[model samples]
Target: MTSLDDLPIRDDLRGLTPYGAPQLDVPVRLNVNENAYRVPEAVALDIVQQLARALPDANRYPDREFDALRAAFAGYLGHGLQSAQIWAGNGSNEVLQHVLQAFGGPGRSLLSFTPTYSMYPLLAQGVGMRWVPVPRADDFTLTPQAVREAIAEHDPDVVFLCSPNNPTGTAIDLETIEAAAEAARGIVLVDEAYAEFAHDRSRTALTLLERHPRLLVSRTMSKAFAFAGIRVGYLAADPAVIDALRLVRLPYHLSALTQAAAVAALRHSDAMLSRVDELRTQRDRIVDELTALGYRPYPSDANFVLVGGIDDPRATFEALLERGILVRDVGLPHTLRITAGTAAETTALLSAMAALRAE
Candidate 1:
């Protein structure tokens, strides 16, 4: 067998691991921050019908511009957005890659707060750009003063901010976003993958787009819409930003099926997002119950909670697995991050933790 070391891989990627979480066959899975609810049958049926219609046109390529899909996304986002301001890809990861390709490259750098979306640095490196991570506050928060200082020191070509940030699920204040835009002499990209789960959905970077021509906001259909398997992500920016992405994007990158699925899903957006409120309730319950159990869970605006105070995260992770539940050990000291699952699943997670403490 040819080992990776024996093959001619890039030196920069030699020791780095691909991004992923455990995909075990456990009864209760709270890892990966995916929406725990299944798509409603009515919405699923509608999507199947749309796919069926798109199959006949498979021989020909999809709408290269995906104009209809873009329009749908603009309608869904509704911060006075229009189709010209929207751009999409197979997933938000691809959308972010497009930004890096267009705005960042060799000799340039990508800067973001530490412990953000794990993929940010990897995406930067893949494009031959330098990745600069500035640590967040001790409580895993970022303030305006901190944002200004980091940008001034790094002077990077691209700044990535993950709101309702991953791992800790801490959201960035608008003031901090404003600070980054004002201080940086480059593109400001806000990865709002979890924005729908935030307590105040209106508090988004989309609100800042009119003021900051360089600001970019990315979103996905995976979480709130429970369309993860479909792989649809999009961006809203000044139309000029969308034009720049077009220069770097492959012709017809989004397949006909993906466009159909996403469009169909958005048509019934209300049904697709019906479970969001319930998921929010479960997330809050996790925080409260964990606190009562004497564990420390960070304040979360996303659909997950990052709990600390573990004697050994790996030990507790394995113990939870043994009890037929699964969570994430997100490489933070004495901490575990768990997705907000269904009510029954949340009960199982809490019950298992309580039992572990009793023992």
Candidate 2:
């Protein structure tokens, strides 16, 4: 029998684990930070209709540029961005990979504050780029002064900043983003997958693009749009940055079905997103309930809460699973992440936590 060690693999990947959250068959699943609601029936039907239209033309290749989808993406970002300033891929992961492929390479480096999206370092490693992890403040927040110092120290070719950061749900202010950009000599990528769930659009990095051409912002339909199955993530940047990404992407990478499905979803973007306010309400409920349970909940602008004060996060996670609820144990000591799901799901989680704490 052959083994992985027997074959020549990239040395950087030899002992590294792939990124994944548990996919358990529990009743109240909040892991993976997915939009817990199904796409509205009318929108689902519209998606089907769009996909149906594309099926007949499956023999032909998809539009190489995905022009209409790009336009839809631009309209959604809405910082006066032109379609030329946007690019997308299967998911934000692939979109980030494209950025790395274009601007990051063997001799170059990618830098990000720690406790970020777990995939950041792996993406850099995959492309033979150095990954520099700068620790954030104890509260999981970054100060502009701290950001400036790190950029000056690492001098990386690419920098990643995540607002409403994963696992912690802390947002970065525009001032800090601007400071980081000013101190960096290379590309600054702001991952805003959770932006739509934020309190207001004023906090978004999109507003800084005209003044900072080296700064880029990436967004996803997976979260707010309930389009995780669609695998669509897009970015807004200078047209030249979009051009750089184009050079490295595979020909006709997006399938016709994907483009059509995304178009259909965006066509009713407002109606599709009508549930966001309700979900935001539930997210706040979780924060309050968790704090009331004697846990410390981070200030979250995203659809989930990163809770501390658990005696043992892994044990608490399993106990909740046994009680027919599931949440993410995001590898942080004594902490867990629970997605702000539907009203019912939120109730179930709160009830479960209350019961567990009493035991």
lDDT, candidate 1, at 350: 96
Candidate 1 backbone overlaps, count = 0
Per residue, candidate 2 scores C-alpha lDDT tens digits across 111-197 of 999899999998998899999999998899999999999998889899999997997889999999999888998999999999988
Worst 10 residues of 1 by lDDT: 269-278
Give lDDT per model, in order.
Answer: 0.93, 0.91
Error of 2 at 120 (Å): 0.2
Ten residues in a row with the worst lDDT in model 2? 10-19
RMSD of each: 0.8, 1.0
Runs in model 2 deviating more than 4 A are none
Scored by lDDT, the top model is 1
- Candidate 2 TM-score, C-alpha based: 0.98
Using Cα atoms with residue i matched to residue i, what is each candidate's TM-score against the true structure? 0.99, 0.98
